[model samples]
Target: MTKQLPYSDAELAELIRNGDAEAFRSLFERFIRALVYFGVKLTGDQEESEDAASEAFQKLWQKREDMRGYPEMRAYLFSIVHNRSVNFVKRRSMVKAAHQTIQAEGETHSDSSITTRIIQAETMVAIHNAIDKLPLHHRDLLHKIYIEEQSTTDLAKMLGTTPAHIRTSKARALASLREILSDETLLRSCIVFFFLFSAK
Candidate 1:
């Protein structure tokens, strides 16, 4: 048997649309690794990137027949990855913010470092629970910058909104969080500590 030649991007697209499973497999083999790397660049987590890539492929396969034109297919596939990665980061950030909120409400744990870490972990969990209660948009904004670790410029580009809009959204979210927690002193400390730790 002769060794099979790799499909061109055009051939791959046509094959996929024609319900050729082998063509889809070949396309995945060709692009999955590079796509994963690109996803990680956007999401900063290998596991999340892998998941996003897998989901993108699944979506491509599912909608292959309806997909038109090679460029559009590629764009749609990547858009899935980008959106999934961003959403993943957003959820994680909301949880982190919530945990912080909870911890600040708790008493100091034992002075031992180990105990402190435990208490801090508990605090973080509590904070997450509180954030879980926030409105969807507020939680989403926090997740974009805090959990997903996206640069403001990149986030602005991704969201197709201005940096000032992002800043205002973040500000409004933080204000709402403070109101929810209803602890002025804790909110002040959170603001200070958040900036200090983030800068590092």
Candidate 2:
């Protein structure tokens, strides 16, 4: 396919409106990373962010015919993925109480939401740093189970252990994580950690 990389989102939308697959692909490539990153910030799960991005693009394709009146396709995509990310979190998270509490706080004080977002980035950093403080095996286990969302059976097989052991280790790792997040220095990140470690 010829390069459509130089086209603006609006131009791409125009081309897509006429059923141009290359134009749609171009827009997808252009915004996919940004959307995934945005989704990650919202949902705190890389896999879910990717799923959200995919869903957003699918919606974009279906809604291409209605693109003419929209001011910015990028913004339109962001809006869709943002909603998708929230729904993803709500559907999958075991920490719905914390999520709802944060949402309520955000609504109670509008600018507080923006402040919450800024803290979210910090919380991610804090979580990673706390994870690093764990033993090597625990760190790896936590990454596989939580970050990669691996099942206990699969993770146990990979580690040459029984699923029971994996579950026990996971519990220990989570206890350690809770301890680490409880530090006063990492106060902001605690809620994000809660939002993330849902019903696994």
Candidate 3:
């Protein structure tokens, strides 16, 4: 039998545009690490780098049909990630400034409100840490659906799976996250925070 060759990046892009899950996975695996490294060098923050890289991949998926070739796809991914990292830095700066302003103002807020905000922030951090410990598929699913707010139907099409299966997998992933975030207090806070904020 003649040996078969791997698909070229351009070919993979075409396949991905046609909703080939394996091709998308191959492309994601091929470039995710390099993109993350690029983001880290630009942002100097590992968490932010991962977020930027994830967003870049999500953007690629969204615009798969628009990609003309491998070179354009590669350039687009890098550009998206770079912009995301820069925006993250700017958002962080804005948050810091707001925090400083709040401190300087010495505004007397209700203790309960402050406590709730602190708990929500801490719980969000814990949730992210737990997500980082999950398997790649589960982590990606959660981040894409929840963080990026991608539609389940779109993800199903991209992954070549049914929406029901995606929902089931997401349920399992959430169960695993709940297990990982087993602290009762934090879990309760996380649930409340998600319920309140997710409605918006």
Candidate 4:
């Protein structure tokens, strides 16, 4: 059996800073999957979560020395993950919200002749499609507040802003999404993806 390596976060940080590849590998093994799961939970997108977690780990490796004296290694790692996930979600929200708004408007008819069920179905699709296009910040806000059902106070605290600020940000983000997606029309059957390139 391979010898077990017992290391503290500070020691591991030192090892990484000293350019110990084995230490880095150990650290990656310990945290990568957990970070990815956390990212997915926060962002509600598996691929984006994976990308964020991977990118965050890459960044940590690049700046290993900075991890020293962090008091809480897990917290520090999760912080990076949170920031990256938030940014990704916001960007997506902006783009997707816009697209959804336009699509929904296009499908809505003035005549009350259309079945309510059909309208709801089409509107839901438009909503999801637009959400898919939103900017990372906006998308992140929506997911945290609405999808994840986080309390405004908790979100504000996590974001380092006040509850009022969070509310304002959400409003502005929504407005921005509406403005962008109000008119842009793509083929109804086609899907637009912003995830073509992963963040390195």
Candidate 5:
């Protein structure tokens, strides 16, 4: 049987639109459990689902005037939580499947911070391979500048070249490395992966 919107629900919905806090509280108390259950069924994690439900209620408060009656209000809340759950799933999938694109090898670690986690071993290997593919002169230039931390002037003095030439070579080497490292899917996954962990 369909869940009918009671007259009391409709009355409270209108009251909330008029900025009545008591009525809003009544409505929240009435529907929060069902909303959380709805979210949990979709996300499979109670905490995340409840968080989504909370966000939905916050949105519904802001958008109270947009929806009318109990049915629209209930649907609106469910819609917001459902979209949140689906978008999160999509983001997780993108990162988790990063290796499928590179024909190579990767996590859901909550501590995946840049300051703490730094770069992964596989990412470092991929970067080293990309650098190795550069022209020998470009590779040596990158190594001296980045790995050895040589200033342009220092590099120039060692290589019997002007600092201006070393600067130009550094720019070219970085550009070449970027081209070699251009794996679109992997790059997208890394971005999503980083943000995902940071949110936790």
Candidate 6:
């Protein structure tokens, strides 16, 4: 049997443009963590970071055909996240100022905050329900990876498998979760809420 080589980022982008789901998955796995970290640095909020990263991926997928190569794709993804992060920070600041003004005027602003918390809680519940619907192994793998932030090496040791196997498992788990959370807007919101708050 001939051994197949891994695709380069450029090759993956081209394949993604051609409507290859696996190619898109490869690109997602390659850059998601780095983009999230960059977003966190930019926004200083874990939830906002996840939101920015998710938005970046969504924008990339939407414009896949326009991407010329790996460098351009990478730049575009980072740029999207950067803009989203900045915008989120600005909005947060405005909200904070509004809250302070309401408080100064002896207005009851707790209702708005309570509503926000309730929405977040509901999103978290939905995310957990979706995750719970996954196969047992996949659910466990996702929890360990995203919630516990376990290294593949550590997971491999615990599961009596190779690191490569753990990586493959993670990819599959992610696909399953994506399928279950098919509503893009809900998925984005739930993902951010779950990763930022539920994980802890």
Cα lDDT tens digits, model 3, 11-33, are 65676787666666766765676
Better of 2 and 4 by lDDT: 2
Please say which candidate is ahead in TM-score: 4 or 5: 5
Off by more than 4 A, model 6: 1-7, 99-200
Supply every candidate's count of residue pairs whose N, Cα or C atoms clash at under 3 angstroms: 7, 0, 0, 28, 0, 0
In candidate 1, stretches whose alpha carbon ends up further than 4 angstroms from where it belongs are 1-7, 99-200
Error of 5 at 164 (Å): 95
Q: Answer with 4 or 5, whichever has the higher lDDT.
A: 5
47-100: candidate 1 lDDT, tens digit per residue: 988888899999898899898856667667666876776677667666777755
Measured with C-alpha atoms, the lDDT of residue 133 in candidate 3 is: 72
Candidate 3 residues lying further than 4 Å off, grouped into runs, are 1-7, 98-200
Residue lDDT tens for model 2, 13-131: 67678767766676675567667776787778999889888987898788888877325566677777777776766656535565454442211224566356535644565566577
User: Could you tell me every candidate's TM-score relative to the true structure?
Assistant: 0.45, 0.45, 0.45, 0.43, 0.45, 0.47
lDDT of model 6 at residue 27?
70
Candidate 2 vs 4: which has more TM-score: 2
Candidate 4 regions with alpha-carbon error over 4 angstroms: 1-7, 70-73, 99-200
Clash count (model 5, backbone only): 0
Off by over 4 Å in 2: 1-7, 69-71, 92-200
